[model samples]
Target: MRLWLGLPVASALPRAHLCVFIPISERSRKDGALSLAALGTWAQEQLQRDAGAKVRFVSVGSTAGSPLEPYTLHVPGDEEVGYKRLPVRILKIWHYLGQEDDCDWVMKADSDTYVNLRGVSDRLSCFDPEEEHFFGVVHAIVPPRQLREMWPALYFGHGGSGYVVSRGLLPKVGRSALPCLEDMLEMTQGDAMEDVIFALCLQRRLDVQVESYGFLRPGGAWDAQLAEQEFVVNFHQARDELLDRRPKAPLQRWLHWDAQPPPLHACVMVAHPVENETDMMEVHRKLRADAAAQVLALAPTASEWAEPERMPLGLGRAQCVPSPMALARQAEVRLSAAGAPVKAFWTPKQLEQLSQCLVHSLGKKRCGWTDIREQRYGLSYWPPAQSSDACAEACCRSGADCSLFQYRADEGCWLGRWEESQAVASDKVWQGAVKVW
Candidate 1:
């Protein structure tokens, strides 16, 4: 489909679905295993669970490639993979991966970042591979007054937060389709940030936009509340800045509020800023536990957990097991007690009936309603809808002003003019009706 670095872009050989690359420094590795150690095992676990998945994790560095237990790729460059030389490291990654032509997508992440490989796959599902799409938490590029003439207010994805590059655009690197390493190093005087350089290359050279995925949180932008409900793909913790509100770069604005962690929500796929190797392992352990809890929640019957053999992690029989429906009710009660307005309770059968009737009345096959129960956000409130269909209709009728709507069988409908970057986990909330423009 494309060609670059004097090599064929697409080959007849089998290709992995995604190639996740993390640039590492000898200093970081000396500090500990780096996030890749746990991540490699995590990736392998995912592969073991799903045979069809072909995702590879490779840690790239500038030094001589010493054989790591799992995987490592050494690119020729200066040994220091620090801020100033980040562009070189990144360009090297692209060039190497591009020549391989063994993956549909190339994801460049920092060693400090933890990636949820499954979540990455899920997010990429909606996008097409043929198109040159860049996915990440996008930031607007605003230069100082002095440099306004030279630099416009453009946008780029944060490298620490990690970003994805489609295979289609990989071959373009170091060629006319994209800037060569020499040009990039010269243009930035070898001191430019890698993410900014990447954004510039995609926008000016390839005329492509960086599609922002709000779920990818970086710095103090991590929302502890939203992660409880939404499927957050990744989180970036660069240095001690995960909790710091200070902007990493003068060109980027610090938009999100600060939030703490510890009781990491089950909905978060990837988490960032785990600078400590022990913390990285702990994060993975906690995520595995949460995943197991999800499996327990989805169990068909409480009796299933009665057997000691089936019980996992020595979960005692004395543990009071609650049904999924019961748990949902408990969550609703908590929200209701905390100032959430009470609404009518509809049985499953009744909800299904309402859903069918609303579909019939609205004459739309797909209602587009998402069961975001235990989640709530936005400032606008509208009359309650009887069903998710009714909420979608209301949002659609509200015109361009409404970008999304949250509906609850009990609490009714809420319209949002702007797409919410964060939503708190609440009871009985169903978010849907994204206005297609």
Candidate 2:
């Protein structure tokens, strides 16, 4: 039931405690809701529905929203640029760790990035609770062209997304976050991708082993025609139409901790009873604690886990999506990854009506969907790549676990003892090997 492979024999791991922090930078007034209050309301609406997944609405930047109870974030000015976002997200995770006692893991994601809860649960359900490791999107990040435009010294990758981490690295990351933040601003690229900088930070700094699963990849990789789904935390800029409102697949069944049932009986813990403000607060608090314990306990033991549900979609998942349609036709809209016009009319009344029946949404507007066997991130090893598996063979050959590094092909990735370099291959040839990963 547990997957902790390497250990010191005496090294001990407690239950995996986790806190999912959705770092959202809603343009204080982009939705034309007219005021920052409207932004908060819109964001909260999305955060509330997913209360079951045990996440918090961490509103950052200049948006003056309501009290983010049970959850908190840094409020920076709108004019802040180049790495400001990273510090805000870092500070939030740091604050949570300081307050909690049992937390063993933490996931920071984008608000728009859809989270596949069942997908995540299934992944989280694979632990043994006695190993040391960390997991997250090992973004297929390319180094910057110019030194100044490049990520800061401590940071290596670009904009991080919905990913997991262990408490082992928390103290180091938390302690170093600010210095890296200051360096980000100094670069003055004026770029605002916080995750990118964060990605680099985790890859280079944390000395622990990191695994990337493909079950976390959200929808864009989905092709109804190809039937190549397998994604969990769909990320990198997306839209509403890009979102599959359809009930892709269930990631879990009703979970019962009471039964010593299969340890893999992973359940999606939704924070319920968010009927009022106080209810929202309580639900948020309880969910956070529960997520912390669930993940911490499982991390050392579980082979893998991911937020299988579409990360309540936002710009995070959208920007990375290689959509067949134009950005204007995305399911949701906001500024582009470059902070340009990501707004569009897929939100038209007619589109809205179409959105209502997406199957994932039961009366909720622009609601996220479940993670099918397809549409996963770089966490789980099950769903073979619709695109890449260069590392899988190596991993299996060595009798080791595999992890996916970032690649550009529309395929999937593997984690745990994977091949290091990408071999040149054609699309058609690679497509045939999709299932191998």
247, model 2: CA deviation in Å? 21
Per-residue lDDT of model 1, residues 1-437, tens digit only: 65322224455545656667666665664323664454444455454234223433333433334334244455444346566867876776676666655666767776666665654554454355655667765555667767766766666767766788777777675353225567786776668888888777777777775754323333353343334222222334322332333475522324542233324433354565556666565555555565456547756466555443233321211111221222222223211111212322222332333333333333442334444444546534444356667666655644444567666666666666545536675444365555555
Whole-model lDDT, candidate 1? 0.51
Instruction: Provide the lowest-lDDT 10-residue window in model 2.
Output: 257-266
Per-residue lDDT of model 2, residues 153-176, tens digit only: 222221233556555566666665
Residue 338 displacement in candidate 2 (angstroms): 23
Error of 2 at 267 (Å): 12
Going through the candidates in the order shown, the clash numbers are 4, 111
Looking at model 1, the pairs that clash are 237-273, 374-426, 375-426, 384-412
The window of 10 residues in a row where model 1 has the poorest summed lDDT is 314-323
Model 2 residue 151 lDDT? Answer: 37
